[model samples]
Target: MQIDAHQHYWDPARGDYGWLTPDLAALYRRFGPADLAPLRERAGIARTVVVQAAPTVDETRYLLGLARDDDSIAGVVGWVPLLDREAPALIAELARDAKFKGVRPMLQDLPDDDWIANPALAPAIEALIAHELAFDALVFARHIDALQSFASRYPSLRIVVDHGAKPPIVEGPAGWQPWADRIAKLARLPHVHCKLSGLATEAAPRWTEATLRPYVDHLLASFGPDRLMWGSDWPVLNLNGDYLLWHSIATTLLDVLTDAQRDAIFGGNAAAFYRLEV
Candidate 1:
């Protein structure tokens, strides 16, 4: 049940990915299930959850198609305008499709505190939960309070905290104290889980396990093994290093934990958290 719980796919020329332009033009790499398959084989990843990168339902449906056709992709987490009046309809529409396991709104760009608290987002969120869907919190440290609010409001609905609350370790973990405190608060919420995926990318460029140790340790301690999962973040991690580099960093970091804890961090937790079919 080794699941890379958070990854995305996109055909840049085919659709509107507002975040795929300009400064990131170099990252417009052509990728899909075919590109990831070899990497999965090398890394021993039996399953993957293709998370949403596009801002439209078309991308969600596309990934669903991939899940139907590609064995590596066991589940999908996509995007939806949480505050849109059409959210419920949108969720219902995607629900019938059967591959979309959840939704994520890219709250990272939104103002820290109010993004997830949007008043009009309830209908869609409720619809998602009713349909047995999950929500991936793509938020930053400043938004930790809002994340807490979100988890409290939707206690029964599962929520995954992507990127370990996105601590700014480049400035030292101390700078992330308030955010860490808030994250610990969110961890206490039985519904919330954290992904141990992108910690290296968040640290200084020449990052190593020692440099990344604090953040990883804090999260595992805060979220606990049962609620923690791992993700590759993949091509995005190309920003830090190649896939093997990311894998090596994760492996070295977990060397000190027990086998069961390591298993949960790498696969077990993702299987349970995302309910992937392994």
Candidate 2:
């Protein structure tokens, strides 16, 4: 089953997406399953994992409801306030739904870069590990040290690095070493996974394959196909490119690999990581 593992759906009317501002003109409107179905069909993606766009539990529940009915949505990586003292209870409550496959605490939005390393958050992390749910890490390069520490503390927890940790693409290939070093360090942990998603938005205007190939190659070398997965990043991807564009570039980057390796990066790894029924 071909899975676009990290897409999002949101309603501007919901008024909960604090980050969905007028500055992001293209993404300020509503995006629903109907809009995505055709794109997925065109891309030949049979299933997708809808991830959270807002940090509110209300939004998470909204996505869960969507997952319950949409056969195309294999699972959801929703959000909960992991730093909250009641996080474990909230995680337990949400996990009761078979469609609630994992949790993501919009760490990138949080002011503190070390938010994931808090000892106070241990119970919540442990709860996720106990439940065998995935943790979708929404972070940037600055959070790498904390992520490494967290991965060490919870050796069994399943973690997927979103957007290749949002590399400094605007700065060009010369600026890749710091992010590459950190990614290499994170990939050393067997429990962690990385996504080839969202990088198109990070590039300079009219970016080319040459702009992303370096970062993609570094990640492929670090984690290998079995530990890596691909995601459309969808509406947000519309900022710089579209599903087809990203897919085309990603496919080109993986073209040198054996078919099995390419299949693993595109679909198999996502199905296994998210425990999707597809």
Candidate 3:
């Protein structure tokens, strides 16, 4: 079964998204399974992991409700205060819910960009490992080195790098080298994987396959087939392209690989990486 490994949902009524209010009007609208189904059906995506857009347990609970309402939501990667003193208890509580596949701390929002490398954060990573939960490292270019350090330190913890380091395809890869270098280093860690999503939004407004090839090729080469996954990064990816656009891009992009390699990138890797039985 094909899986759109990354996506999200939110209710404006629950709480206002500080990042979306006043501007970014198009993105400010709410998107639940009702918004996802037709797009997903057109994309031939059978399952998905609805990720958290905010940083709180309430977001996790909200996603859990979405998952329960929609069978296609195969898993969920929600947010929690990973650095909290009750990290273990919080994770334990979230663990009781099967749909809660993992937790993301929204590293970009943290005061210190290198929040992943903080020694105090090790307990959180350890707790995830113990709970058999995947940790989605939502990071930007500058945070790559610190992320690499965290991956190396906790080799047992499953870490999936979201958005291929969020490279600047608009800048034509000058900053990509260092990001690629870190991913190469990260690839050596058997527990690490890369998410092949959100790139269309990373490029110039009118970018085509040629413009994204360099970055896509780099990530495929760095992580290879065994560790790379296909994700839609829906709603967020709509910032640049829709689900159909991402599907077309991914299907065409993986055409050069063998069928098995293509299968892993499309869904096999996600099923294995996220431990989703489907």
Highest lDDT scorer: 2
Which wins on lDDT, candidate 1 or candidate 3? 3
> Which candidate's TM-score is highest?
2
lDDT of prediction 3? 0.83
lDDT, ranked from best to worst? 2, 3, 1
Candidate 1 displacement at residue 107 in angstroms: 0.7
> Residue 246, candidate 3: how far off, in angstroms?
1.5
How well is each residue in 1-278 modelled by candidate 3, as lDDT tens digits? 78899988887667835676747766777889989899888878899988888877887888898888889998999887877889888888888888888988888777888777678877777888999999998888788888878877888888998988788777775767666777777777788899998898888787787877878888888889888999988888877777887788778877889999988888898988778858
Q: Candidate 2 — which residues are off by over 4 angstroms? A: none
Error of 1 at 66 (Å): 1.9
Compared with the true structure, the alpha-carbon lDDT of candidate 1 equals: 0.81
- The C-alpha TM-scores of every prediction are 0.94, 0.98, 0.96
Tell me, what's the RMSD of every candidate? 1.7, 1.0, 1.3
- lDDT (Cα atoms) of all candidates against the true structure: 0.81, 0.90, 0.83
